[model samples]
Target: MITEFAPAKVNLSLRVGALGEDGYHPVDSIVVFADWGDALTVTPSDALSLEVSGPMSQAIPGGEDNLVLRAVRLLAQASGQDAKGNISLVKEIPAGAGLGGGSADAAAALRAFNRLWELDWPLDMLAGLGSQIGSDIAACVWSQPLRMTGRGERIRLIDDWPDFPALLVNPGVSVATGPVFAKFDEAPQTGAAFRPQGDLIGALQVATNDLTAPACAIAPVIDDVLAALAATKDPQLVRMSGSGATCFAIYPDEAARDAAAGAIRQVQPGWHVFPIVFRGVSAITPT
Candidate 1:
């Protein structure tokens, strides 16, 4: 059996542009992976089947629409090979929380199958196929810190990224991405092109997630989540990770992050709060 780890994809800074003539929103962002996420395993089988079991498994669909199945099938078709595997997935990331959980799962499946089948396909090839299905898959396939642009397909690795101690929080609600984009379309921001600043923190402070306002409008609890994170002691940066509901705060160290997590959990017992040391891109090795 071959196993793969699907790390949570976090967008530290997402700068979205207006919908273009191509019917896609252009985006510029800094993305990183969290230490904790889903796990997937694949073994040879006469038929392709998937079994999902985890804390968040009930939130995921285990049918043809599942990204894991789609990714394996796509890889098989593209390689002119049979899609046959007994796949098991343990989902930890919540769906529709803007963490790119689905994409990360797909990427993990692609990588696992690549090894299981002895295809030896490189990351770029797999990422190219990933982009055909979802915008975030390419970054997830790379599984490192990068600057994503041009609808999230284009990526440039960040070599000098700093290790970030982070606290991720979710308000026990799922916010769909389509509606948030639709809301932004009603009144999009008009501004000059986005550019990175001197340092990571400075760049993140200057930039912002363009979908935050609309997401908050759709899910008011996101506002409360952000407020709670900000109220924590000594957070270097606090913002919504992707679209809504799930927010994150960067702290000076792991102690601060852990303290913030405890404080938030105390106030909102039902919410999902996780503290992690987000390592530099070079240090993020696949497990």
Candidate 2:
């Protein structure tokens, strides 16, 4: 059996631009993955199959539309090999919360199959296949701290990225990306023009998610989620990740992050609160 971890994706800094002629919004952001998320296992089988089971598994589809199947099928087509595996996915990330859960799962499948089939493909090739399926999957394929731009197709790995203690809270609500983007089209947030200051934390302080306001408009509860994070003690940075519903706060240390998580859980026991140290990876050239 082969096992893979699909970490939840987080956007530390997301800046979206006007909708382009291609009917896609241009985005510039720094993306990271948490230490916790879905877990997947694969075993060689006569035919390809999938089974999803987890706290949030009910929210995911188990049929052909599932990204895992789609990703693996694409890989097989590219490799001219049969896709044969009994795949199991234990989902932990909330669906439709803009955390790139589906994409992460698909990336996990690609990575797992790369080894399961002994393809020995490079990350770049896997990411190329991922990009054809989802905008976020390519970044998830890398699963490292990187700068993503051009509607999420372009990526440049950040070298010597620092792993920071952080808190992620979901208000037990799922906010779909379509509606959020629709609301954004109605009245887009003016993006702040800025550049990476070499100080990642500082760069993040100046950056913001353009989808925050629109997402708040779709789900008023999102405002509460952000407020809850802000009320925490000494959060160096507090903002929405991706579109909405899931917000995160960066703290100076793990101690601070854990305390904040405890306080939030005490107030809202129903909310999904996770304390994690965002993982970092060495730099690579832009792809």
Candidate 3:
């Protein structure tokens, strides 16, 4: 059996450009991995099957439409390898909260199958396959902090990224990406463009997640999360990560993050809160 931990991703800096002709938004953002995530286990089998279980398992789809199953089918068809396997997903990240939990799970399956079948496919090829599953799936395949642009398929590796600690909070609410994107009056039309300034950490502080406004509109609780994070003193930046609902506040160190988490939890006991340190791209430590 092969096991892969699909770590949750946080968008340190997400800039959504105008909508594209394909009905997808062009994005320029910096993404980072967190210690919290889901788990995927693959075992040899004659037919493909999947079961999902975890704290957030009940929230995920369990049928053919599940992204994990779709990913496996896509990869097999692409390679023409008739591979089959049974996959078990232990989900912890909140679904539809903009944490990219589903996307990460699909990416993890691709990586596990690549190793299990000895396909030895290049990472680029795997990532391209992932894009079929979701925009964020390709980035999750790399599982590293990167400057992502052009509908999330374009990635640029980042070095010298500072180890910033953060507190992630979700209000146990789900927001749909489609409605959020639809709220935009005009699709952003910036071509693939990114200008990195200062160090990785500083560059992230300067950049912003443009999707926050629309997301917060759909789920006002997201605004509450941001307000709660901002209430804590010394938070480097308080903003929503992706399309909606889950927000994070960066701190200089773990101590500050821990303190912020504690304070937020005390006030919002129902919130899903986690204090995590940003793992650099090279640190592939599984969640």
lDDT of 2 by residue, 165-238 (tens): 99999999989898889899997665764457777888778888889999998899889988999999989999
- Which regions of candidate 1 fall more than 4 Å away from where they truly are? 282-287
Candidate 1 has an lDDT of: 0.89
Clashing pairs in 2: none
Q: Which residue pairs does candidate 1 place in steric collision?
A: none
| Candidate 3 Cα errors over 4 Å, as ranges | 186-194, 283-287
Predicted candidate 1, C-alpha RMSD: 1.5
Better of 2 and 3 by TM-score: 2
> How many clashes in candidate 1?
0
Could you give the C-alpha RMSD of every candidate to the true structure, in order shown?
A: 1.5, 2.4, 2.3
RMSD of model 2, in Å?
2.4
Model 3 residue 26 CA deviation in Å: 1.0
Of models 1 and 3, which has the larger lDDT? 1
Q: Where is the poorest 10-residue window by lDDT in model 2? A: 278-287
Best TM-score among the predictions, by candidate number: 1
Choose 1 or 2, whichever is better by TM-score: 1
The lDDT per prediction is 0.89, 0.89, 0.83
